[model samples]
Target: MRTHDWFSRKKDCDDKGDPEAVFNVLDSMLKDSLERLKNMRESIPLENVGFDSCTLEAVNSRHATLFGCLCSEGKWKTALWLRRKLIQKGAVLDVFAHNLLLNGLCKIRDMERPDCLIREMLEMGPPPNLVTYNTFIKAHCLKNNVDKALYLFSTMATDGIRPNRVTCNTLVHALCKKGLVDDAKKLLCETLSDDKEKTNSDLITSTILMDCYFRSGDTVQALGFWDQMLHKNIQIDLVAYNVLIHGLCLGQHINVAYGNFAEILKRGFIPDCFTFNTLISALCKEGKVEEACHIHDVMLKMGVAPDKISYKMIIQGLCFRGDLVKAIEFLNCLLEKSLMPEPLIWNLIIDGYGRCGDLGNALSVNNHMLSLGVAPNVFTFNALILAQIKGGNNVRAYSLKKEMLLNGLFPDLVTYNMLISAACISGHIAFALDLYDEMLRKGIEPDIITYTELIRGYCMRGNVKEAEKLSTKMRRSGSQIDHVPCKILIKKYCHLGEHDMAFHLYQNWLMREK
Candidate 1:
């Protein structure tokens, strides 16, 4: 923390009658290290650092704000160190600074320390301000300690500080999030009556109530509040409309969502990205691809440019319809908009074709993904590997698994599982065993499907002994021998006319289930 040269430079610049140069020198010195920053704060006279009111406030405000953020992030030690440095610098304690410290302590849930700070604020020096109380109230509310928040709110008036809109809104949001919509509504009504300005009519509180009601599956009360807002002539913003639209869409009231959308437009409030995206995504989910496409066209007609997500939603819809060609066309439009293709979109297209039994088109889409310069990640390879295996080309699937490793991507457990199942299917029981060992060596734990595949392979080859051994191993591995595999074994025993063994297996499995 030696500052010999920096102090000399500061004095030299100050003597040269360039105050700005002196400030610059101090700034550079303090920026070097937090320790140095603390040292400078203590050693340098504020008057020498161009001690105009603004400059002094700026320096103190920066320190307090930075420490507050650190506290919020739970960096308790750093925040404490900064506070100690400020105290050592003989900095005057202001309400804002105290609030910052209290805010941080509250964020870390340091219950005792916050009470101590509150005591210090009230008894020692600078008293707690409205911001101070609000911070504590917000912290308590966030932790679902609404009773404590309510206590603080009640105490605010005794201290001659009226709760503002922010305080009320914080409580309202917290109550709604906790699904206490009735309490939130009651609070909002009380706040509106007390304010007399009706300032809470901007639809934010109503939106929260509406969302809470929708989430609780009380759509009747949600719509009633909407009507109440309309009757009261509360100005509806696009955000309010979006909330209503999204809620209706989620409730599967598609026609109602559409009506809200049309009403929004009729009121001359143009639909934003959220409005269009919600309708499009909901319609797509309901297998109404044509209607989603029509909405996209409407967006274009209204000069509301669709974003990357909007296009992705439509592409997903088209893929669901097995219209890969149209999906790719929409993808190209997305690229034209300067949005880079994501692996998720590519995987969706691959899976869509794969599920349709169109392996050729799926591979073509994968190659197109490469041409677009987006390297296939694990998900990409996973989808393609599954597709290749489903097409009865286990050899190609195996090669792709190797290529995945060569491209610096480790094959995941799914890749190994698919390979094992593929080998078992082709009657290469020994190879499947070797693959299972390799998976174990790589720390890939076998799931029920892996054991079932091997067990099925053994039973198919009439090696019931090895099949039972693997089943025992699978059960020991903490997974139950699933019904399908158990049924296979019982049938094999019955075919061999071993009715006693078949009954034993069924009884044991039923006992374990119970």
Candidate 2:
């Protein structure tokens, strides 16, 4: 290549990603150009016109082209310097200079100067056009003032300017976000009723309509609207399918959701973490564990790296099915790679171990959780207590409760209710009553579960007298902790031939629902 061509190519790359070469070229070229333009002015136009006129005229077409290239590369300062030289000529700036200035102002938030700059643009010979209005609307949209963007649309028509497809699409998007779907429909009807192929056929506008339909639970219309968009040949992006897939999942149609995900792949779009997470969750909800695992293998096969959420979804599914063994193995896999699971993921594993009467595994997982610097909260300790009680180990369960209090985490109603129920189920009526008193002394108000557990404990002990007393107390307390306790009372009383008390209890329980 010629030496000048080599220098030019290197100089251009400098502005792109090679700043060093860009700087070197501009430094040498700027000094040489300025000096040459000055000498040339001394030769010709300096005698007949203002010195600044010679300077602006010295800015040749080649110089403007170079300025434009720099602007495209985001070297705004260089472009601004060239504009200033032209303005200094006592020559009003031209349309190209004004448009570039508007674009630069919009790219950066020069909020205070927009109106002033627009006025100056008008003061120059060329008046503003549709491009100017669209740029201004885009500026408002960037600041998230959707209302002002709509106001610009009305102003455009009144100012005798014809709005284009982009202008209408921008208005539709802004209105839909504000939930003014009716007004959006009204505007679209007026504009696109006669020209459905031109206006209703716009992809951006149709995408927002699909979003509204999906959100409103009109899934039928939401899916059908795709045909219009497809007819217009407006390529649906990832965001479009994301919204659709989410809607399908909400309606529990996981199969359809998977179909949409496949379409996204067929269209050459890469599925993001959100897409994968949604798909995994749907598969898990359907208990398709084997298919969910297959997705993990496919993700690796296709080079789609699984994010942390992907691991969390699969782990949560295994935990839900009481397969804590596999869940723990997967969790360890993530940890070996140094990715700590979230607290919710840990809680799922804890719940699984607790339910299986495995206090040892539960406590082990809780200890590993603390080692990861995630503190166990009220729900965390509650799970362990429930597990131990289920395992017939109340002594250790109470110890865990003490540890919980010392950790500054107070037991909530769920902890109290579960503890008392464990006592009842274990036939420890006296222990259940003692805990109920302690709960009252602590000023923790008893709810339906607390009262029902107490009543059930008395009935279990065959102490019909005390059970009747507690039933009266529950009646005055007003409302069912559970109506099932009333049924238990009915069954017990009728078995003993005390039909009168059973009738009274059933009548009171039924009245509360009214």
Candidate 3:
């Protein structure tokens, strides 16, 4: 509804005897007004924008609920305004209302206001409770301010509010993320020791430590944690199994990881996309594309739908094996499934065909990609350019460079290097020099490949003096003078019967090596 219509409807709300109904209308009106004001980019006070004396008077007793409604909807600014208005009228907000406001503020990382509110709660009647401390602790942990979170944790005990599993879990996850796994372990141990039911280390905490150890490459320690969970009779969940599978895969324990996958199915725990993708990625990396494809087929047969990752991994596996025919089949399958493949997926096939010297299929894929509305990116153009260069079609390669510019994509270092190399090979020394000047203008630094290409181009034109000067410039620019350009110059010097100059060049290279 329009903002003005809300104001008009607010007038009819008083005739409704239900105070709850009147407050609901007021909440809806305020929400719509806030949205309108946001879209208009207006900075007017929310009170003036929506609420007025009549509306406030009508819902005076329902201030706390209204405040909660606003905060819950993430309209914190409007909520804060209503809160201040309520406070100005001497309304006593209870601990629940205060906690709601604290939650809202903490979610937005508005630390300053929450600090003041916590102080007010401490000094006033409704002291902060466990929920209040947890909210602040969680907020600090999310910001990676573990020190502050710990301080709040210590104060919780002084306030006679014990830190529960949620509090400890937050800190534990934060510590693990910061790579302070040892500290995390110590904290978990201390918290568990303090618990009267010392055996109550839940699956979440155990899985977190296991995942941490796995990521840190301490497979032994990670497995120890897993064994500990099993010993404690903890009901292992799907997330914990996925972590083990991923960690095992990372550690190259693919056999054991697959063993666990089988165990997951045997235990009636259905594997999800992550489970299949992890195995597929591992098998593909190990050059077991067939095994990975088998896993993909098994996923389909089991009625577990493969996601984008599933399709990408399988297609990438096929492409890496140079199985372009199977890769295209999978691509068509992806299209039939109505899953729009990303540009990376298309680039993989294009690059695969390019590597096999099949420029025809590569260009066909590029055209098909464009028709499907997936605009070619830099990598897309690079693959095609490299293919053109490899096929000895320098003109087509340079044309692709121009196409890249028209598509709003700047030619990157690889693009320039390939084009420069191709120009030198085709004896287009002047054109190669022009490309070098363009590189300098575009601020693309010339690396070893670039300088080598340009030096070779000058040597091809028999401009040995210019080639020598470029060699000096290349060294000054910090590109290591590789043997390719040096040998080129030496050959040119010998061809001109300048044996003395060639010997001098060799002597200087030897001296620089020293």
TM-score of each: 0.72, 0.66, 0.79
Ranking by TM-score: 3, 1, 2
Best by TM-score: 3
Descending-lDDT candidate ranking: 3, 1, 2
Error of 3 at 386 (Å): 2.5
All candidates: CA RMSD (Å): 10.8, 14.0, 12.1
Q: Which regions in candidate 3 have their CA more than 4 angstroms from the true location?
A: 1-73, 123-125, 194-200, 459-468, 480-514
Against the hidden true structure, what lDDT does model 1 obtain? 0.83
lDDT, candidate 2, 1-514, per-residue tens? 3534555576444323555765787799899999999866655532356546566556544454665677678776667666666555534444555666667667766655556667666675456678877888878777778877777778777657777766766777667767777787788777654444464346567778888877777788777777776776676778878878887887788888888889988999988867777778778888987678788877778777777888988998898787888899889988987888888888889889999989889889988999989988888988888888878898888788788889998878788898899888889888888888988888888887887888888887888889878877877887556667778889889988999888987887789667
Q: How many clashes does each candidate structure show, in the order listed?
A: 0, 2, 0
Candidate 1 collision pairs = none
lDDT (10s digit) by residue, model 1, range 388-423:
888988899889989998899998888888888889
Model 3 RMSD in Å is: 12.1
lDDT of 3 by residue, 1-514 (tens): 3634555577555443565765798899899999987756444433555667776555544766776788888998888787776665445566777788889889888788889889978996379988899899999888889999999988887888878777888899999988999998888778754654444447888888889999989999999999988998877889999999999999999999989999998989999989999999999999999999899899999989988898898899899889999999989989999999999999999999888888999999999999999989999999999889888889999999998889899999899898998898899988888898998899998898898888888887889999999999888888776788888889999999999999999998889889
